[model samples]
Target: MTDPVSEFSRPNVAAGPNPFSLSALPDNVAFVALFFQRDHYCTNCRSQVQDLADRIEEFHERDTEVVSIVPESVDHVEEWQSRYDLPYPLLADPDASVGDAYDQPVRFGILGALSDFFGRMPAVVIVDRRGDEPVIAATHRGRSTFDRPDINELIAELDELRSA
Candidate 1:
């Protein structure tokens, strides 16, 4: 079976990198990909991002940057950041291509039959910088989820992926 992470590199990733028209991203950077949905994980993830924000020093020490990517507008980003107290950059990718690039979805099966579904980016990722292919530092989902994961454990896992 093909690995799920490898699935991201496939050619079918369409429709994202929203607010910014620029294609591609910096190669030498570590970023936690915070994908959003209209609700669900998007809203919940704000809390996670805020928690991460509260400990900005730790994230900087680990050399990881928290970037929240969403199809929402700048207004949405502003509202969420202020409401949730998130301290990181809330980037808009209205096209949602960045979410497609990450390839990990929250519910994981809502991509089909769009008429009947509302979906979310149910996971978070710490992607490695400077790699020919970005390495996934840590992903959160399935059982011991984000709000519940050991913060220290998450920090440790992220710490281990330090980019040179």
Candidate 2:
């Protein structure tokens, strides 16, 4: 049930003096929802991230950690976070290695191949960390740029996990 991406090092946008890494998640963390974004240019993706950002406290109350991964550099993610005022960490996947590992799409069709150079398809991967090793609990792969998980549904799922 282990996904090696959990062992990868990524730059945390909010990491301070004591830098953070995926492997360094808090012990109390019940699970981690990894939101894979195409890039800062996708408004739908931004909105999705914003929705999660707005409900960060609820996530904390449920002992779940949410993170974002973008197929761009740390600097780009930093700028995007500042623009949206996101409180959670945005992990940089400059080469899309993590995205590739999770099978996050690079494009849809021939014309979409253009995205291969600049973007990643939107996706949501929930990894339950309560077990000895992180396990994939659920996942949603966007069919289009605008596709994303429903906020309410995501919350409900997290709540269900909390009560389990």
Candidate 3:
């Protein structure tokens, strides 16, 4: 298995340069909010992306970049970009390599490993870039389909991190 990705460069299907990476963030960007999606058809995942998109300005105000990682092909993710026109970066992690790197939860053991829809849950990884190298500042690993954090909660976490 490939090692967990501490930093990644992937095709960006949303409003930004192509193939966004941790190294390519603007100098003003202090944090990166990586929202890992469960699958292409997850309603909760869709809602979360939309919610973030609507509040992207808040992240920008905090010098953060909101990136949504979808474990699907670029073509499939493009459909989402077309529908929502997200203001942030929407990346396609088709092979789930990035998800596995972040240890995204998988349930039912072998069965969950076999199918993402059945096993893979959502995750939010906050990467702090204030130091010499980017580091994981916080993580919210969902235990169930509905167990993800709220938009305000994410903003609050970023606010706290910035203050500290």
Best-fitting candidate, scored by TM-score: 3
- Rank the candidate models, highest lDDT first: 3, 2, 1
For model 3, the stretches where C-alpha displacement exceeds 4 angstroms are 1-5
lDDT tens digits, residue span 1-164, model 3: 11233877899999776898888888789988899999999999999999898899999999999999999999999999999999999999998999999989899899999999999999998888888778888899999999998889989999999999
lDDT of 1 by residue, 1-164 (tens): 11234322112112223232212444334544443333323445556656766876686666565555555545665566557665555665445555656653545354531411244434466666544555565676433123345457767777565533
lDDT of 2 by residue, 90-133 (tens): 78788777888888876646755566434457899888887777
* Candidate 2 residue pairs in backbone clash: none
- Which consecutive 10 residues in model 1 have the weakest lDDT in total? 7-16
Candidate order by TM-score, highest to lowest? 3, 2, 1
Clashes of each: 9, 0, 1
Give residue 9's error in model 1 in angstroms.
17
Better of 2 and 3 by lDDT: 3
lDDT of 3: 0.90
